[model samples]
Target chain A: MKAVTAFAPATVANVSCGFDILGFAIGDMGDRVKVSLSDQPGLRVVSITGDGGRLPLEAEKNTCTVAIQAFLDRLNANQGLDISLMKGLPLGSGMGSSAASAAAALMAVNELMGTPFTKTELVPFAMEAERVACGAAHADNVAPSILGGFVLIRDYAPLDIVKLPVPEGLYTTLIHPHIELRTADSRSVLRRQISLQDAVVQSGNIAGLISALYTSDLKLLGRSLKDVIAEPYRALLIPGFYELREAIQKAGALGSGISGSGPTLFVLSESREIAAAVAKVSEEVYAKIGLGVDVSVAEVNPIGAYVIESV
Target chain B: MKAVTAFAPATVANVSCGFDILGFAIGDMGDRVKVSLSDQPGLRVVSITGDGGRLPLEAEKNTCTVAIQAFLDRLNANQGLDISLMKGLPLGSGMGSSAASAAAALMAVNELMGTPFTKTELVPFAMEAERVACGAAHADNVAPSILGGFVLIRDYAPLDIVKLPVPEGLYTTLIHPHIELRTADSRSVLRRQISLQDAVVQSGNIAGLISALYTSDLKLLGRSLKDVIAEPYRALLIPGFYELREAIQKAGALGSGISGSGPTLFVLSESREIAAAVAKVSEEVYAKIGLGVDVSVAEVNPIGAYVIESV
Candidate 1:
């Protein structure tokens, strides 16, 4: 039997000023998927670990199998397969947990199928899985998880994804607090109509961030990490959010903002040492607030998803 | 007497997706200003030409003298100066006529005073001139006129302006229709509030535009040059706006949009020949509507304002 195991990195979406359009992959944490051919003529979820028995076991319900099924349907391949998922990221943690699983499964299944689709071509399948998981087919998380580095979802109709350059020494400190904030609830809090002034401010920040990435201007990147559209309202859902951000800023981190929706925060730093310091500050702030948190400091993952073990 | 004459290029602002924040300088068409020291204790306007005597001769009301006065006040220099304004660009044409005059005057006066401030530092004084001219201290016209190339006004509170790279072989075709459109009336037609969905689309286009400029991808740039925020409502004010855009697009121009507000339109092209072709197409479209138009094709001006003669 041909077997393959793949790993996909977790991602931080929104990235401050780039709500619903920008995201970047992070190193050292993600989801893993192992796939093997089976005699049965349909896909099945053999096992799912690290999700605390919360994720669905059914193939159609699971993001991993759903993504694999999408790829198979696109290729018109009906080879029976068993998929096992290992979720390293916390569910509902704003760390792209579902996207990581779907990306990993698609990578494993694609490798098992002799690599019919390129990584860029795999993004739509992952987005389809996103639609199954979160009811919104956003590529901010899935594209970065599959293609690595920074990804900009320019448009969703034709699915335009642009990979941006990552500067050297750029590191991130992510803190996921042990709290549940439904994506629906977080989204419901945003104003459907925003002032044109605020919209102009948001666009200015997006343009600045893109320019900063191309020029490798860390200071400008920090300055551009502002979210006037979503953050002002979403901050009310996360406890100690402002305190943690202020502490991280004082700790020499370049800038910080809500990772995706709520409860997870990301701090950008120019060096590993500063990232570590920001991580420490994040921990102290959360500890003082009596909130348990999982903190990780990692450089940007330049290579998103890859094969781990193939047989 | 020490005299300096400077020239500043006209600019095209609101480049499709980058409303209120983006602009680029155009070559071969602009305004000229001459400043000379006098024994008198205050500034004086010696002459004004090329405006059909429509511009004010009073130093306080003119954009050139007002900007020069601002610069002189900043330097605390009490030296008298005689100013000469020659407007090469058509007024009320959406071609940044006021900005060019202010930028040229600032460059000339700055040189006349021994060049105390760099070009970047002179943007605010030029913005002040914009306020005197249009009642808004906008940098989209002034920044590109002073600094050259594509300039993004990232923020207004602290005046953060970023200069973006111009791709090789990129040219612009500008068509100025002989129609009167007040800036205030054009601005008033826009909605004060917009939906969140439209804001996201606008930001996506902006990020994509910046990324395309960095990568030098003309196709992506053309795709990203969409304006959902300002174009729909403003298009009603311009005669045959949609027809002109469609014709230019069919003529192989990358994209086209209203230059600043209306009446003047800009078409971005990959080469000068295509730009010229698009200009011909634009003229034909306007001619069918019985509207006379002034058409020109020019590359992006990389050097903004410069002293033409100093003695």
Candidate 2:
């Protein structure tokens, strides 16, 4: 049997002002998938680890298998395949857990099949898994997890994704509090209609953030990392959210906000030392609130999903 | 006695996706102001031309005199000055006529004085004139008119204005169909509230437009030039608005939309040839409707307001 193992890193979506369009991959934590070619003419999920038997075991219901199925359907491949998933990110933590699994599985399957598709072409296949996991098919998380670095989904109809330039010495600290904040519950807090004034403010910040990325103006990027649309309502779902953000800012973070929906918050800093300081502050804040937390500090992942071993 | 004459070019605001935040200066048509130091102790408007006696001659009522008064107040200089206004642009044409006069006057006065403020610093003073002409003190037009090229007002509270890089070989065609469309009327058509979904789409386009500018991807820029928030309601006010836009697109123009509010339309093109073609098509479209039009094509203005003559 020919087998391939691939790993895809965790990603931070929304990035404050870029509520639904901007996201970036981070190092140190992610999901790994192993795919093997089989003589049987079907797909199967042989095993799933690190998810504590919480993830669906059935091949058709699993995000990893669903994504691989989409990719195989697109390629018209009928050969049998067995998928093994290792979830490195926590579920419902708003850290793109489902997207990581889908991306890793697609990467492994694509590599096992002689790398038929480019990394960019694999984004939509992964988005199929996103649609299965979340009601809306958003590309912010999956695109970054697949392509690495910063990704901007400019439009959805034609699915335009643009990879933005990353600045040097930029680091992120992701802190996940041990709390149950369902994505659906978090999304329900947002108002469908927003004031046009607030919309303009949000648009201005997103524009500034993009300009800051191109010019490598970290200060401007920090200033532009504000969310008026989602954060105002979503912050209420997370415990001590405002206090944690204030502490992170005081701890020398460039800016901090809810990473995706809730429970997980990403703090951006100019240097690793500041990022470490932010991590310490975040842990202290969560501990004060009697909530345990998982924290990771890493530079933005420049290389996204990659084949770890192919034999 | 010292005298200076300055010219400030007209600007196109609300560049489709970037409503109330993005604007760019254009060449050829603008307003000119001559500020001459006199022995008189108070500011006075010596002459006003080209406005057909519609503009106020009183120092406080006119945009040019009001902007100069603000500049003098900031500089703490009470030197008597005589102001001459020559309006190169039509009034309420949706082409930033008021902003041009304010910028030109400020430039002339700044040159008459020892030039204490930088071009970026002069934006707020010019906004004072905008407040007088329009109820809101908007910087989209005044900022670009004062500092050449594209300007993005990231924030209004602290007055953050970012000057974006202009792509080479980029040209614009501005067509003004003779009509009476007030800015207040244009603004009233807009809803105070907008759907969050539309806001996300608008933000994505603005971010893409900024990225397109950095990469000089004219095609992406054209694709990003879509207005969902204001264009839908405002388009009904302009005659043959959608048809004109479609014809311009077929004429090989990159993208086109309402210049500021209505009556005037601005078309962006990659080259000078395409811009000329767009201009011709725009004229023919207006001529078919029996509406006379004024059309001009020019490259983006690199140096905004400058002293045309000084003595």
Q: What is the lDDT of residue A183 in candidate 2?
A: 86
* C-alpha lDDT of residue A71 in model 1: 95
Candidate 1 residue-pair clash tally: 0
- Candidate that would win on TM-score: 1
Give model 2 RMSD, 1 decimal.
1.5
Docking class of 2: high
Proportion of true contacts reproduced by candidate 2: 0.93
Among residues 3 or more apart in sequence or in different chains, the pairs in candidate 2 whose N, CA or C atoms overlap within 3 Å are none
Reference-based lDDT, each prediction? 0.93, 0.91
lDDT tens digits, residues A1-311, model 2?
39999999999998899999999999868999999999898889999999988999887778898899999999988979988999898887888999999999999999889889999999999999998898778899999999999999999999999999999899999999888988888889999999999999999999999999999999999999999999999999889898998998898888887888877999889999999999998889988999999988999888888989999
Candidate 1's residue-wise lDDT over A1-311, tens digit each?
29999999999998899999999999879999999999998999999999999999998889998899899999988899999999898899999999999999999999999998999999999988999999988899999999999999999889899999998889999998889999999999999999999999999999999999999999999999999999999999999988987898899988888888867989899999999999898889889999999999999998999999999
Candidate 2, residues B1-311, lDDT tens digits: the string is: 29999999999999899998999999878999999999989989999999988999988888998888888899888999999999998898888999999999999989889888899988988899899998879999999999989999999989999999999989999998888998888999999999999999999999999999999999999989998999999999998898899899999998987888877889999999999999898889998999989999999887898889999
Point out the worst 10-residue segment of candidate 2 chain A by lDDT.
Answer: A254-263
Structure candidate 1, residue pairs in collision: none
Badly placed stretches (over 4 Å) of model 2 are none
Give the Å shift of residue A62 in candidate 2. 1.6
Q: What's the i-RMS of each model? A: 0.4, 0.4
